[model samples]
Target: MLAANAEEAEKFRKETEAGDYDLLEGEIWWRDRHQMLIDHGYQLRPRLRPGWEPSWNNSNKNPLYCEDAHVGLRLAGGGTIDAVRIMDGKDVGIRPIKRVSSERTIFKNLADAQHLTGQDQHIAHILDTFEDDRDPDLVFVVIPLMIPVWFIASSLKTISGIVDLFKQLLEGLSFIHSKNVAHRGLWSYIMLDAPSMFPRGFHPSDYFQDHSGVHQIKVLPPCKASGPVRYYFADFRHSIDVGQDAKHLIFGYEHPVGADFDAPEWTAIGTYDPFRADVFIIGKIFNEKFISKYENIDFLSSLVEAMTAKKPEARPTAADALKRLQTITSTQSFFTLRHQLVEKDSKEPESLLSENINILLDVAFHGLKIALKMPSRTISLVRRMKRGSKEKETAK
Candidate 1:
């Protein structure tokens, strides 16, 4: 219950450098006994500062991405991770942390405590969550530094690319859902890592403690595929646990996941089932990928029609959405359809340059063959070109 701020956080860092903070390394490892399991290629890092959490984007010091091993990745807040090392080529790499099931036995007991009960906690679980400071009576998450994918998923391209971006996110939420935990505040920044390091999961200085009641939903638009374009979720401090797979109303999280994403009742209240909620977000991901944004408006329109069906019972599940996506092949190499699409809006005028005409023709004819599912288009295109010598000359 100690209030950690910049001044106290800075003071603690100075003390860590002054030989006061323990790194939790070697021989006698860990203040907690469970930590003894980590060894060999395993390493641990305590709370650190100057990692820099922006006030606007990150907001908190303890984003839950902080950890016990030195994975070197970091996050903004309320993210997920786990222990255990995996074997790599000649060397072992530490497993990126995962959830311990927030609804499971170990963490549920902590939830019963009054101080943390109503603070809107949205995380999955803590390998070991508690507050600490370099100084006595201080509060912070005492673990290694970790980073978040949500904080940097903007640079990737392709629908496949963006869908994959939520790798860690899906893992976190999936783990929680498997255990029947509902992350009420699945907003934009819930995937952030530890802010400072004292409280391990919720560093006091990392974010403003909400004495005034706050409401939120963690990140919506659950991942449809695996890629780099990610969506941030929430303010962990405002998360509420309604019940197992209970459907809840959270504005902005209503993007379609897979088809099964629905509520027994439309309003985001008691019937909030996490599986359905997650599936809905995944369906939203599909919209961005194959249906809504990219090249074919026709395909997208039909997909949305299926996704937006009014009755929750009419919605498709993640499995069903995956089946729908099967219509969009990952490979389109038949190399044979007619002009499947025409691009009048390409920004590159150089694309019309004569120097690349043959190359463009080759690609265009092949693409058409694939789209029309015709093997004869290749020969047909050649015949058309031979018959239109004047037109080819003009393009040249």
Candidate 2:
């Protein structure tokens, strides 16, 4: 893989110097087999089509201003691509994996578990898999196209959003752990199924644009009003199923130590419990993306600290963390849950005032929706909070 990457880098260098950048050197594979992919029920973008000419070519307008200019927009990983499923027209991700890799076996296990137990709700489902006709040793895995967790989290304005996100993450980890599978890397693989949030669907590359990569995306409503937003754990390349041997320890990985973010215990020297390492990875993700950035979410400080403890044995299991989160959140009132989080670095006092105003307006809208018998998760959450408060009062 290292040699292949280096070869691609060299090709890229040559293409840059030649001033012939129609298609990226790495993207040549997709373009070369465009018709083959189409015949297999996936449609690549216009830019990737064979014999296609750029619309911006010889035009007075800047290429950057044209939608076709974004052909170079690709995921960090080189082999993966975003395409539209020909049958349903829904966007999907296509990733190639060697036949000998464990990823295919892991996905099969997850799929079986999801079908029988229905506990794989937080895990990404593999849509389809097909062999590459050119290389019998290579196969492409198709998955639902999901937005990055950070992107959806950044759009969130209230504590409910953050709480819900963490709950799903913890629940996901717990489910995978229950199956005796340890996801050694958990940071960048976390994604959200938020198709409802964007009415027109978003471009896989430039999320700010619509599916066509031309117009700006149109969002429907805040997460609270948009029904339940489901989060999923993707990328099981580094994951391992210990089966009944939950006590098994991993020596190290043949690949990199971590999946984008390195856990403290992943020194690649000695054997360590991958399950506990998974816990720390989740904690690191939450801390880096949320706790460190938001000032008002201090309620998670102790939980985060415990999950990221230096001692692998000291960190709470995914189940424990989920329960702790529920207990912590249950005590807060609906108004408190609806409280908008202030960014720690947000020095502007007026921003807080604006957030407060938005919260009030959201509450009013939710109340109106409730009165009209319209769908609102906020109403359901408020009712649960009320019930909890009543239960506490009776206990007292």
Candidate 3:
């Protein structure tokens, strides 16, 4: 009986060796500290847990076809991972950073800040922070998990949706500036908080797929149906507090990097104001993402041009930029705000058909509401249209 048991154990070991169950070099760090993270009230996926065995090992089916085959794939950046809170079953982002890093310090300062208001502050909130058990130099920070803002913004159908998105983004930048801080690395760090859009949740490794990695996630539009979404500034790894006097010039990297490399000052001779560089970066993002693609939203033309001006000194301050945006948005009519955003080029036949169909449906629905004299929203829209027409005639 002992000899038979030994043979069975050896066969199992050989099968495990042949299969791809072992953790990769990049994933070993997380697997090693998996138990420590669990003790801290977070649990990694089953694959990352110790003593994990491939569920399809004994089966005749190929592991590649199994649902659990790619459960805990590591993200591109080595320091970050997605985790689940054991107490409340909420999703959270985990990142291990140096204990004395500026990123950690900025997160602490923002969390403790009293002057920042809830309405205008759009930075990511730090949920928890703790030192790693084995590494004194490393600390793990927990924050709300969010997808890129463009994931939500790209699918928007109306001008009003884009306006709301930019408003929140500008307000967030302005709020950060108010704290005497400049987000040296902008654009790429902006994220969206819209849990309702993905009611079924999603796979951490593959955001386009469901949590089980079996099917595509049904992404809800960022309309009234999905509830209002907020944009936030995240990943302050390149941020710095420039002091209240605002005279500091940063000269770190010898070469241009990040999304704002096109900014004239990034490759200039000496140091440059990070604040103005931030504005230029935001403009580049806005133009590349929206203005350059969409035919409408011309109201934002002047703002984008000024923000991306060749000279950094010519750019508007965050506060001034926000004020300018607010003023321009205020002058827009109800129809203009609610109108379908036409794309500059719809080369794909299917996309053109879908866009045109959506435009027709939106126009019909709004026209029906106006014809029915539906409640306060409809009435206000009518009043605004009339006011806009009167203003146009007066200008003429």
Candidate 4:
């Protein structure tokens, strides 16, 4: 297998030198390593032509090089299709044993979490692993392929759709926390779905052009789906086990920097409860992505606010947030209520007032409470203003 990989790499190198394909240094390295996996009985689909490439430089000569290629893999025994995420082991800055140990820990954490949650559908499962014989340092982790949540959000027709998706995510998070795993990185891209058709790659330069000219660069559109969607959390590279106690603290500056949804605690100088950080991450997603964009579902404002509370201790547990979601879904029925109110208000103002008298009464009740809380002088001033306004109306 080693000799075969070396031969293939030499062949590819010769082909590239002959001007057959303009391959980058990282691309050449990936092809060479991938051949070894194939020799070990792993069947990979044809390289998706025009596949997306990371914008960052990945040349072997560059000190900051890293591989971010995504490829489809046929699971052994033809059970299911999965993705192979190829990582350059050198970039992690850790010994091979420690890195492999971390991978084992993640696998165990997910396995235990699945059992505790009864094989929850919202968590992405790892299928297999492969070690590159050619580059003993490179690791290939296999996981289910999924569509990004942002793409699904584009097709959402109502606030109710968004709520249902979020509910599933909260349930998944609750289960993950129950098993003492902290997904330090929780964002929209982390949420994904298994769709019917595999996505085809396209060159960004084909669709987008600058004044200079079209620069042919491969990229994949965000994944999309047509029917029912099941959201799952993926990318567990940053995941950590906090133990079943839920209060276990993990210290690390490991969270992705400059991520919009990253928890503020991640930037602190000392140890922090990762579970609480997870809550903040989810809350930031809900607050910025869903609630802020859609005004009709403003009822969720308080829930997200509580989840993203500045003080870690003040933030609700994932389980508490899940329970709150259930209550909101059952009681408020905001989508239906919002539509009805809009229709009624548009068709007949008087009928709308009569039908929603309770809403008006509630407003007045709160106003009266505010008035009662004011000082005597403030109350007297309000009364004088009211009388003055009435006199002006009478004069008119």
Candidate 5:
């Protein structure tokens, strides 16, 4: 419904024409839309797109997403911090998600992004805290998400679904970069969502006594058997041991925090190279997002890419990395559960020439027209402003 003119309205209509526009389904409370099992706080689709709900009453449960509780406290320096209870096992070698926490450009404020970890939806959320000179104790700033009893253990059915979810993580990172904040804490948990009903190792899900570990048992992760496992980063209380004023390496998705996620220029002055440090970390996320995991080669290549740059300025920003991923997914061929991924030979001279010709024609026909009109449009805008100003001056 948000449109500047008939052209925009028609564009919206065309965008939906490719896919049937189903009124998004969910419940309505206080004139607000709420999904099944989703916290009443959620206002849009679980994936966080903007759309309208049909009647505000969908299934009480969509078996798709989850959420977590809030954490952290405020500090004297205006920074907030919180802590997560990291399970001893399930992850040991896994590193924090990203390096250098930030919020403006690359990061996002997910109402329930924190709770999607280890459940059906595959994602990890950034949560928890760290120390700062501005505060006497770690600051707890963000609200934790609450996961549903269902929507756990999403299946790896299609790589596209996973990719779609994963790309959102990059969007969050891009949002962080735009804001010029660092995502010092990135990981499987922080990037993914965590289920709340998972059986604690301390508490077994026993229908009957299992003295021999042979009881009729179900090993359902706190998640429903629908999608891939989600992850959520906890313990932000220690998130910034070396970040912020001091630039500590927050841990989760990356293997080694500072050295691995840091840029080339940061090798010597990482403690002070905050922006470059963040960009290097983002390159790692980009490589993994577009390229499938193989041997440690993926990790190694990411390391080389993120750190090999001569300077942090030479490194790619999170937004830049997202652009790379966009090109990769839209153009490059990659293996999936269904498709055979392979690179087609671009050196086929005839095909290449034909493609180039088509592109040239399209640009000259459509793109060039739009480009030429933009300057005239700007001139018109300025002319309108000047005319208004003259009228105001004459009245005075």
Candidate 6:
């Protein structure tokens, strides 16, 4: 759900409080943390009532033990453009960091990845950091407000649209891997719409209202030209640097289990290449979300199968996977073949002559039934004509 308007959010809060719903343990934690952030000059946007929930890993049984909290926020001074802070009052996004070590690591990883990617359009840009003065554990990281990829995918009307999104994700992942970073947690939920475009079909006035009872209208940004929309990879909390050496082993004995996205190798005993695990995550996502659903996108079938191979060694490197994707997309004949197959499958089989004859007889029977009622229709029309003539003659 999109962020709620101020009035709606306030009403929700009041209702929750009145009903004693605000006293729930999760709600209490959220309220306290939220107030702390507000006290430190970070202004959060009104959250959508039904959709906003505590960001907790399913593996973690305790609701209060949250490592990261997702919320819509903005800089106090205003919007910052291109790394420079400005005062335009635009809404940004924030993800709270619960652990001091995790916060430091994430900040460093984001900065290093940014340097490596360097204005690459597919990577989510981290804007700045926020910290609470009183609490050492509470830290907030700011980023551009992005529409979720699942939201965008649901709106997509064609196979080509899904392909476009997948390609962008591959490109971003390739870049990250090239920089020797492994995004341990890569899934469809972590992908987001590009910052350059507004939320699909959104209007500012829909969320904002004039208070003085006067009609207030404002111009909105121009719609972007129709093309492949850009997508970015977000949520770097589980990310790590793998260093320059490709053979460098990273141990994952302490890695949490039970999540579907967790690479199978992590659960097995010894050290594993984090980069290969990243590829496995991406492959799993592609196979489950795209390949399994759409038959025409069989071009990616073999590639996805290989990337998701049970053995970590069998999976392709991110760079190799990207190269294969480029090759498949560049082949125009594959798309032509796919179109032909889809068109052929969509065509209905020819009906038997007996069926056609039955249809014709049904049409004729209906026609005769209508013809039987024509005399009454004609009588009504003649009476109406006579009545009109009498009225016209009287008027004359």
- Tell me the spans in candidate 3 whose CA falls farther than 4 Å from its real position: 1-22, 60-67, 71-77, 114-120, 252-262, 347-396
lDDT string, candidate 4, 244-295, tens digits: 6646886657676567678878877778888888888888887877777655
How many Å off is the CA of 329 in candidate 6?
A: 0.8
In angstroms, give how far residue 43 of model 6 lies from its true place: 2.9
- lDDT score, candidate 1, position 107: 38
- Between prediction 1 and prediction 2, the one with superior TM-score is 2
Can you give the lDDT of residue 111 in candidate 1?
A: 35
**In angstroms, how far off is 295's CA in candidate 1?**
2.7
Against the hidden reference, what TM-scores do the models get?
A: 0.35, 0.83, 0.80, 0.58, 0.34, 0.60
State residue 328's C-alpha deviation in candidate 5, in Å.
1.6
Backbone clash numbers for all candidates listed: 99, 0, 0, 0, 97, 0
Off by more than 4 A, model 4: 1-21, 40-99, 115-117, 186-189, 196-228, 244-246, 252-254, 334-396
- Top TM-score: which candidate number? 2
Candidate 6 TM-score, true structure as reference = 0.60
lDDT winner among the candidates?
2
RMSD of each: 16.8, 8.8, 8.7, 19.6, 20.4, 18.4
Residue pairs in clash, model 3:
none
Winner on lDDT between 4 and 5 is 4
**170 in model 2: Cα distance from truth in Å?**
0.8
Worst 10 residues of 3 by lDDT: 252-261
Which of the predicted structures, 2 or 5, would earn the higher TM-score when compared with the native? Answer: 2
Question: Weakest 10 consecutive residues, lDDT, candidate 1?
Answer: 209-218
After the best TM-score superposition of candidate 3, give how far the Cα of residue 201 lies from its true spot, in angstroms. 1.7
